[model samples]
Target: MTTTLAKDPAQAAARHAAPGQKRVTRRPNWVAGTASWIWLAIVIVPIYWIVITSFKAQSDYYAENPLAPPSNPTLANYQLVIESDFVRYFMNSVIVTVGAVVPAVAVSFMAAYAIVRSGRGRFLRYTNSMFLMGLAIPHQATIIPIYLIIIKLGLYDTPMALILPSIAFSIPLSVLVLSNFIRDVPKELFESMRLDGASELGTLWNLALPLTRPAVVTVTIYNALTIWNGFLLPLILTQSPEQRTLPLALWTFQGQYSVNVPAVLASVVLTTLPILVIYVVGRRQLLAGLTAGFGK
Candidate 1:
């Protein structure tokens, strides 16, 4: 098809803009740019302090400007943190995080596929509402029941104690997000799979899983972060020193190294690296999920 532009430049620009007949140039929004930089500074300043302080000597920390980089950076604080059984806590955290996230994501994906594919019924509505209700409930309110249940199961002071609750809490939001992504899959693709003699499980595995992978990765990252940083559950549910996750260990580290500010900061930095790595690796899928979620 042939397209024509208006005689006047501004009018032509406006007219063709909608039809892709012309390109429009616009000035940058300076206010937004300025605000973005300002916000970036606000965030970066604290992180910069934490990173620099971690390398400073305890004596130097009190003497030096908080924002200034250490002239003689040292690894003593890091070495000390490692010496304080940080490795055991780190392994325990890995156990709980991986233990929880795998089952949680798997169950969530299956439940989501079912919810989206199932036709509307009283049961389905009730089930979806039940999952949505989990989101509204505060985590603190369930502590008593969770504690009692753990005690009864003889799983107290075990990594399983943390893993079980983490999985339960992860499911509701995971299902909600995954279900929406699954719903976006074209129905005709499902029909085609059906005609090719695929079962519902086969169709879900081959069709919906690949298409909703970004959302899956997004949830996996989110749940990992949540479980990794979780303090309360670890604090209340487990008591043995071996059961300590990073957050709880950090708490104990702060108490022991409270007078040694540089040591504490070093411990904090070590505790944060795994979470930082996971977020960085999955950031693309995370951003894609966020965009799709908020996009109109």
Candidate 2:
């Protein structure tokens, strides 16, 4: 009777899930919950402060209990922003970021594919190492040369000035991450496609790329964020209000006297909201892509 009862589905399941084979572990749950809350606070608290501050009046910004939610909230700052050329600045940022990231990601994908599947050779290793070397090279030291080149090419004070440099800078990093991801694709899959009479491009387009969607999306998100938030390249290269990005426009808040704190905060709020949206939308794919090369 006892043996029959133990063989029952629920009983068997309970036995199988005894402490050693438990389906859920308290340690992992506690660790994950603690880490999640810490990350949540780190991300949420700053944005909360910014949003709350954006609603406060200038006088209230300096109030004793500034951290407190505003007694009265208003949209005066947003009104000021709309009246100014903030929209134009936002558009410029969008154009620059898109122009830079699209080409960078596309080109890097091809480069990574070539590097990974091409073969083992001294040149290949050197080329791969050179990509890593790029990360070591500081942009600041090269800014002057970049500026001169842009000026010589008559691209200064234009959005292309920012787009070109941003793309150039992003390519190396993108290729590095993408190479690892492409290498993670099962070699047999590519071999099978070839055996079935698919060309190299067909194999890449139909076989490799479908599985690498997560990595590609993650790279795109990361590159977009980098380009969107870029400051130095734009600040030095572009000279006109028509060409300013959101980060540059925020500087307008600081005048010689009588800075508009709320207005500046409002611009910041506007600048960051799109990025926040992008990150929230792409976060799952980003994590998946980042971990794609790791074996489950």
Candidate 3:
């Protein structure tokens, strides 16, 4: 009986346990948790204020205690925007953003593929230097020239003016990001594809592109956000209310006679929601791509 008890696994485990070997409770520290909640509140308070303000009456918004909860929240501001040119502004923004990002991604993918697969030469190196120089050229300095070109081309006050210039500016960084990712793809895979009679395009489309999904997602998200939020380019490029994008249209809400603060805030909320959604969805891929590119 004694030998059997001593040989029991559970008994042995309990008997040989080290002092203070109690199971560790994984509960979070209360003070640390409270501090985190406070930090979160600090971050979210302004956003919450904006959202609440968007629902409040202008009089309530300007009350002595502006942070106080709205006595009456209404959708009048949203209704006003929806009844007016908001839809047109939304469509214009969509058109320009889509037009820019799609072509930029396609062109960047091809450029990256060629640079990674093809043998490096003086011409390619020079071309790449020119691409990087684009980052150095401030948009303000080139805006005047771009405006002149737009007028000469008769694209003034058109979405094309906005789309084309954005695509041009976005391509360099897109190409650079894609090149780093493509370069990281195993050379053995490319060689094997070639041995199996795969052409360069086939290899890129079938092998390279699929492997760089994270990078593609990253670049697309970055470009989409930048294009969506762009102000100066759209302001100078588009003049007609019909051609006005969201950012430009939002400015109309701030008139000299009466500023509809709630309406303006509502418009801001609407404009930002899509970008927020895109970032949340693609955040992991974006971080991976950025880290990989920088590390490489």
Candidate 4:
């Protein structure tokens, strides 16, 4: 009986309970639930409004209540945006993003590998310090100097003007993130590869690259988004209508006194769709890369 009572405490408690005793369960926190729903609504409402407004005619959009669904939804806004130079602007954005992000990731990964693998060399340490310092400098502060340098190099108003500055700015953050991720890789694996007569490049390519892929993907997506949506660089650097990116192209829809609100919003929606797709595809990797090394 003692053994039975010891093995089944619930049964024993039930058997010995006084009359009218009842189990009490913890209640769900309704306040927290309500707050979560409120926050979700705050976020979701704007996105819903943008999507719905994109379908409304400009006349209807201004005439009807802002939050009300369009009585006669139309695709004219999308048609107008597509009929413009949207495709050319889109291609320019793609070229600049790819041109910047690829080289930035490669160079940053290599630099990060060296910083992690090289043991306290003065130059490497100084280089790492310079990278960290870059994070403190605001882009606006350097725009004038960058503009002058671009003119000196005769790259002003060219896609290379945008690409070079983007790569330069992206490097510091990329190195920081990649170096941290690389530091988490087992030193034993690197040692084994070295013992097997693999060169440093081989080990970096074969070992570090594979292990740090998530961080690479994260930084690539991040840099892509930054360069894609970058307005200041394109605005200050490029001059011609042909050189304009999507962000700049939206200005074409605005007249002196009035704005084509639906067409402008339509441009925004189209521009954002690619970014949304990229995030959805790589979100898991991004979360993993960010969370890695936190426990240590």
Measured by TM-score, the strongest candidate is: 1
Candidate 2 structure quality by residue, lDDT tens digits, 186-230: 899888998999988888789878888898999899999988988
TM-score of 2: 0.84
* Strongest candidate by lDDT: 1
Query: What is the C-alpha lDDT profile of model 3 across 1-296, one tens digit per residue?
Result: 35533388866788898988994458879999999999999989989887888888777778736676678988887787777777888998899999999999999899888877766777777777888899889888999999999999999998899999999999999989888889888899999999999998899899998899899999999899889889999899888789988888877755621477887787778888878888899999888776765654
Each model's Cα RMSD: 5.4, 4.2, 4.6, 4.6
**Candidate 1 TM-score, true structure as reference:** 0.90
For model 2, the stretches where C-alpha displacement exceeds 4 angstroms are: 1-43, 121-126, 256-258, 293-295
Worst 10 residues of 3 by lDDT: 251-260
Worst 10 residues of 4 by lDDT: 251-260
Model 4 Cα lDDT, one tens digit per residue, 238-275? 99989998787766555521466877778889999989
* Candidate 3 segments exceeding 4 Å error: 1-39, 256-258, 291-296
RMSD of 2: 4.2
Model 3, C-alpha of 232: deviation from truth (Å): 0.9
Off by over 4 Å in 1: 1-28, 293-296
